[model samples]
Target chain A: MVFLSFVNCMRVKGPDKFWKRRQILKLAAHFYGRKRNCYSIAIRSVQKALQHAAYGRKVKKLERINLWKERITAACEELNIPYPLLMENLARCDIALSKKTLADLAIWEPRTFKCLTQIAAAKNQSYPPTVKAALQPPPEGVITRGML
Target chain B: MNRPISTYKRVQQWAVFGRLWFLFDAKWQNPFDSAEKIAKYLAGKHKPIYHPLSDVGDHVVVINTKDIALPNKEWRYRMYYHHTGFAGGSSWTSAWELHNKDQTKVLWKAVYKACGGSLLRHNMMERLHLFPDDKIPQELMENISDHMKQLRPVPKALHEYTEEEIKNFPKVFEWPEDYVLN
Candidate 1:
């Protein structure tokens, strides 16, 4: 009697069964035809969609960062400067502005952006200018440069 | 004995070159000079820290390319060449024929050739946009900070007449009833 009572089986369906199906079907209403009405298909799609939704929220943050980087680069160009140079100079001068802040200045405040560019331009680089000379137009083919 | 000289020097060399967004109005401007400016910005040559290997450049939005000025009779003489690697499939089209088909192509080609296939040129080309008219995409519009001074003033339309002006104009020359201008 104890062993028989201990054994649980899904043979007998209860209110929980219909409740689970109803929840899935309701969520799947936006889906086409059978996925909404058919419990089996609805279960599969809703499962996948929930997984995608969870992953998408994480990716949205990275996408916004990339957009800010592009905006900042474009803004720097408006003042006739390069993005990397501005970043380096700002860091050298101990200005801890973020990409979002720089991008905002590029779009909303042109004069301020220009001022920042001038400050960066004034801070001269100590490296041999030849580092830039390496940036010549390459002949359109395989390059065999042994030196880094 | 000197205070961290090597670290400071290295930091200065690697510092970021701030990018700028420029607007180029191709309307009625000499195509050659416009192309030169486009290439310079595309290659990031306008900066002191510009390196061919590094993508340190500005974005350029070019508008009104339809009205680009071509000097002399280059419209008839200038040619765009293309070829297919086959038995016989080479073709050459005049500037006028090409521009009529797509107004932005002329300036686009000019910037491409000016870059001369440099390291940063292809990525820089991604930053260079060409539009036939002033209608820019909303996303690109946000970054535009300043415009290059126009080379020549946009001329007033010679033959255009407003609807109200046409209605009010006095019919100075009267023709016979049978005479149809058409």
Candidate 2:
């Protein structure tokens, strides 16, 4: 019995493992019923919450980028310039503005955004492929030169 | 016949091509459970592009609405209710009574309730179709490339063994000379 007790003690789980589980349970303390009190369910909740949290972080970034793109596109449409053309000319003119900043400018600083659009429009006119594509005759009874 | 599973590979094909149709059998199915299941397809709940407003859901054709099995004695106890604005206009009928009259009504009502009860519910309901029997229209059947798994497995019917098979069956030991096989 004495030897068995010693062996059991030697093979016992380390304090680190115990503390890690306890930490996860602490994080899951707000959970209800067995999910908070029981080790198995609490650990599962913590792991699932962690997985979703990681996914939410990526989703947050993507959603913000989409919002910015939508804003910029709408502003470009009001100025009669295509989004791709405006972005290309902005890069050409060394106007290194992030989408978030551009979106803010589009909303709050419309005059400045309009000036930028004018520059892009001028660049679009002088540009070869864009101008040619814009001026192309309807090839196969298509209604419009621009993509509908 | 073998049906292809709509895994990531198959869904990717839809991105290049288009959506596919699914068939659901409501034989021995519960109202609430089947409603929730069908609602997922009707509301586009299973798709990644699903939104409450976007019309991304696929067509779902349900067969055997007549054989739908309710949990417990709900066919007797459960009520289908209706009322008009006029006095003494309220009426009630049992689920079985309603099903006997219009077998598809019970399932339709269940599905209507399961849908998110928003303004978009009507749009979602439009994609759902119910048939009382297995005799589906040919055009609808032609597009059904896959089948949804049953909620609970249908139990196999039991039958007695045939006399010829029993006689030919292997036995552990020969019967005693005096003993007679029953």
Candidate 3:
């Protein structure tokens, strides 16, 4: 690690460039053609891929939320309750369940979801005529203003 | 994990992912509305474990599709379009015309449209079994363990009502003796 002049000393990069290019090349190993082996090309593709990987992490979360909402909505529809009504009523009832949990219950524990819908439906006074007709009597041990 | 606990977990996983056959009686139901619900089940959106890439959709046995009711004059005005991918190859078929040609086509088309243009649309459609009437095959009937509630109740026509029901109907006011019946 000796430089002949101040100019050469300034030109030297810290540590080694091999490891730097190796890091980028590792990520670009699966890339095609020159992108996999060429340092300049691999660095560009690696940076772009890393950016996409970062963005996809956030997108994955939102997509899961959307899917949970869809599943919950489907379950609500099957029970003759609108998604909003069920969510509002559940919140009002102090039943703080996340969309993920509700969706899980809807599929794996449908009977439990049905009971939740019944509680929600019972709490609300106004309902669509068709849903009203289809509504079952509220479960025992729970009373709402509508019942009173 | 212990062997017994691992076996129990495996069984739980199977139970959670198992597909069920749904029975939807489409008699007197609006096909468009019914299709929306049917599409949900067909796509397995009703399940917590549903993933767009996973093949977890349930089978739907839709009976009495021939008797589906269309709102307004949709049967006359709603047209299904087809194209042969050539010049002057496009054709339009009315809902009624399509239904007449095949009793299940109208509802099938409605469900197809309801499923949207996802890559999984055809896969979901394969799970739907549309019967023109209630005469479902024994194998399919045996698979159905749950029924989808109809969106609307079937209305009873005057002739369909019993004599006792008509006689017991409350009248707002009796027709005046002098009033002549139309």
Correct interface contacts retained, every candidate: 0.00, 0.00, 0.56
lDDT, candidate 1, A1-148, per-residue tens = 3677545753666578888889989899999989889999999999999999999999988776766676667667766667887888777767788877876776567678777766665542332134562353332332324221
- What's the CA error at residue B2 for candidate 1, in Å? 20
Question: What lDDT tens digits, residue by residue, belong to model 3 across residues A13-57?
Answer: 687889988988999999999999999988888989999999999
Q: Whose DockQ is greatest here?
A: 3
| lDDT of candidate 1 at residue A29, scale 0 to 100 | 93
Listed for every candidate in order, the interface RMSD values in angstroms are 8.2, 11.2, 2.1
lDDT: which is higher, 1 or 2?
2
Clashing pairs in 2: none
Single out the weakest 10-residue window by summed lDDT for candidate 1 chain B: B45-54
Q: TM per model?
A: 0.44, 0.47, 0.77
Candidate 1 lDDT tens digits, B69-177: 8999989999998898886889999999999999999888888888786566678789888899999999999988877666667786736878788778799887899
The deviation in Å at residue A86 for candidate 3 is 4.2
- Winning model by lDDT: 3
